[model samples]
Target chain A: MIEANTPLLRMVRYFWPMVVLCIGLLIIVAAVDSTGDIILAQTLTEGLVRMVMVVALYMFIGNSGIISFGHIAFVLIGAYATAWQTCCPYTRDMFMPGLPTYLLNNSHHVVLAVFLAGLLAAFVALIAGFAIMRLSGIAASIGTFAFFMALYAAYGRWSTWTSGGSTVSPMEETTTPWSALAYAVVTIVAAFFYARSRWGLALRATRDDEIASKAAGVNVFGQRLLSFVITAFFCGMAGGLYAHFVAAITVDSFYLKMVFITLSMLVVGGMQSLTGAVVGVVVLSVVIDVLRRLEAGIGSFSLPTSSAEVGVGLIMLLILLFRPSGITGNAEIYWPFKGDISSSGAMKRQS
Target chain B: MDYAIQTIISALSLGSFYALGALGIGLLFSVLRLINFAHGDFITVGAYALIVPSSAVTATLLIGDFHPALLVLCIVGIVVMLAILSYFVVFQHAQKSSPATMMIISFALGYTLQNIIVMIYGGRPKAAGIWSDLTGQVQISSGVSVQLLQLVTIAVTWILLIALVLFLKRTRVGIQMRAAAEDFRMARMLGVNGKNVIALAFILSGGLAGIMSLLFVTQTGVLKFSMGVPIMLFFFIATVIGGMGSLVGSVVGGYSVGIVSVILSAILPEELRGFRDTCVFILVIIVLLARPQGLVLTKAAKERV
Candidate 1:
């Protein structure tokens, strides 16, 4: 191992570039909003929420080298938690008569609801991670997916709390462009710091070689569970933001389609780096937005709107075929005139 | 006794559908270590191949109007060709990637295929009455009646299962494919052609998907863009529960899931009936936790780590 630096300095050294990129992207969104483009602003806000969720995913998957199909379960939990706390008590009582008096009688500010959402999601993750993180490889993946299915089924049936499969609408639409940007920045910074922490290094070590890491005295399960819970927290926050952004919460929104889209973003950006997570979300979101506009016949040479969906899949496939590691391929964009830094190498030296 | 017999018949028929799907998934997983999320799309393609391409609410029979045997042949042929093409074009390029990456690629491929179908047929579900005779009830006992489709489904499943077993046991190509499934690199070094074995697996899997689609579409009588997803999801879960690389395990896993699903739905209370899926998944999680390697443990099921 290279010489050790203080944790604070090491975090700055490792994550300064990602921090700068997040701030820069937020500034660009803010600039676009100032030009009175409400649609663009709304889209950016949606993109920012996705950014938080994707980065949250990266926090666990990137460091631990595990692909989770069920992180969206946390998102579901978060969204519903927000809905439970923030929806009008009258509407909540009408739609969800099965809810307890505490939840049915109360409403909270968006910030507190969002926080509680994250906390609830984190608690669920704590329970699930204990069971799931014990198994490795594909079994673990399936286990998490099963967990997701159970949550989905429960949400769908336990109508008193989730409103079943119907849309839970008229949520407090509090997630503006600025708020989304703030959440994105916070998630990015948290992800960066978590990934650079000692547990993060330990988790990656275990991911590289579980047996070897165990032999080297690493508490692999503990590290994995910690990362899992932390990532779930941020994912839940994103879910809360999403519920407010769309003014609706539905179980369908947090199911297979969302899972695939976010996973694709992570893979396309570079599943191994924080920079990749942010970059992937921005690039794909912009591409999708442009395609949507084109599909709406914005251009003289317009294609059918359905083709836009096809375009996203094809582009992702081509990218995976050409660059399986993702657009950044484990590298981060450094300061002006300096070369890109390979995160793996930087991580090795830091650890 | 009559209710029990009916439940048994339903369970068996449903299990056949899942078993066929699981076999397809298991075959691919054995050779390529890929979950092949697009396998379900192959089923959808098979279903759609019977219908004329149109935007009408009701689809006209394309191959469905043909003689039964010819129709089966045509649907299977189209699905098999599409499967082989996909393997060549998409999977061949990512042959050496990690399982997670390959799975994502397959998902994208499925997404693309589903969208193409949407563009061609429009998003409205189309009704096609193919083999409506299969929908008739057959009374096996004085008081028990079952759908002819259920018996037919079971018969088809057993025939295919027996045929597959025989082929694997008796044929040189079957042995070679098994060898490849066991260890591709080792089999290649031992003079088995990797491409041929992998291609054969894909073809067989595609044929199974085709058969599954016919049975499913005949049962439901409606073809939607995402019709294959639920079956595929169950198949995926079954494949994992049975054991990733074991053929017999796949069949066993399929039946387990099917039986549990049928039983849960049958017994669930009115208000809690919606939670039948939750119960099924809870059972799956319990099974997984009990035996992480699956119900059948193969050498490949053991993780190196």
Candidate 2:
């Protein structure tokens, strides 16, 4: 490993490549926006939201090595949090009479709504994590899944607050591409820093060997809980962005479909690194966009749209079969010209 | 008294369904350490096997037109074959991977299978009128009645459970599977064929799924591509709550979930009925918190450091 003078320097060295990639992606999306492609702009914005969510997922799952299915539950909570604050007064009055007067009468700014959404989700995670973090292995996974199921059921039925499983529509569509990109960058930087923090290293140590970490005075449960809450905050923000981007939200949107896609992206990217999460989202998004365009009939050689989903599933399976560690295989891509930080050397260190 | 009797009977029927599904999942987990997400798709495949593939609103009976006994055997055989094929084709290749990876692969397989069914039959729910004669009510005692189908379901589940216990106790293959479940690496070193035992478990699991599909279709009289998911979810929860690797624990867990579900539905007000499942899930979390290893802890459930 290359010696660094300080922890900050070491973190920068470890994560600069990921930061460069996020910036590059944002610039490309911004360029596309200048061309006045609304559909492409919206797709990129939605993709950025997903990127934030997946990276947030990587924060907890990568460091702790626990497969959590309940993170999407935070997304649901976040979306509804924004929905309560940002929905138009008339719609709020008509459907959500249970809301407090401050939220129901006056629509809040999107930025504040998104912030509160993350805060609310983080609060929920803090409460739930205490009970959930005590368990380990597959038992913890099942517990999180149960938590997800319960949240889904409760949200789907709590009609006065959540519109009782029906679609709550026409929220203020204020999440432009630039705003989403900003959040995505913030999420990426936060995750990168968190992963290099003392808590993050302790969690990874515990993940690698729980008993040894405990012997080394690492509070495994506390570290995992911290990661869980932090990740939930970002995921919740992504959820708020998704609600505003789509201009409508529903309970069903945050169910199995979201869970499968996000988890697949994270796993396919290699669940062990920040680089893997970002690369997985960007790569899968491009492939999906291509397949969707093909399915919609490009030129005269058109295929059915259903085939796109099949192709995605097939490709994911093949990837898992051949390279289970994912395309990046837990290695970060460093700049080649930076001779002090060799890419292959980083790979060797990680492996 | 009558309401209590009706609830008890309903609980038994529901418990039986969960028990069978849990056993299938538990058996696979015992040997493979895989929580097979595709197990639900196997049930769906079994249900669909009864009807010819078409995009119609109602399904046309394929094997359902056969004699009931032959129909059950044919469906079970087809499902078992499918299970074995999946093991060899997909899971066997990923045998050395982590449990999380294997779980995702199973999810992928399940998604692929569901999509294939959707392609063949369209996404609409179809009416599957199988054994319509069994829908009649049978009076069990004074002022109490139960569906004939429920009675049959209960009988079938118990019979299968007893038969399985006998098979495990008396047969060489069954004993070998138990040994592998106890300690797979040790069993392999002690002259047991790992592949053969695992294949046997898959067959038995698939057979259980097949039976569950038939019973479930007959009970609901409708077939949808996703009908198996709810059952699979409950079965998964049951397997965990019963103790992950123990067959007997799976049964007890199933009954516990079933009883809780039945009582909640019976006692909850009309408006709160939809939240019954949520309550059951919360109960599961509490149980998990109380005993993370599960209520029926097996020796194998302990982590080997």
Candidate 1 DockQ score? 0.71
Candidate 1: clashing pairs of residues = none
Per-residue accuracy of model 2 over A108-138 as CA lDDT, tens digit each: 7889989999999999999989989888877
C-alpha RMSD between model 1 and the true structure: 3.0
Q: TM-score (0 to 1) of chain B, per candidate?
A: 0.98, 0.97
Put down candidate 2 lDDT per residue, B1-305, tens digits, no spaces: 99888889989999988989899989988888888988999999999999998878778999989999999999999999999999998888888877767787888888778877887788889988789989899888888998999989899999999999999989988888888888888999999999998889999999999988898888888889888788889998888888888899899988888888998888899989989989988877888889877778777778888
C-alpha TM-scores of all predictions: 0.96, 0.95
Angstrom error of the Cα, residue B296, model 2: value is 1.5
- In model 2, pairs of residues that clash are A159-A164
* Error in Å for residue B244 of model 2: 0.1
Q: How would the docking of model 1 be graded?
A: medium
The Cα local distance difference test for each model comes to: 0.87, 0.86
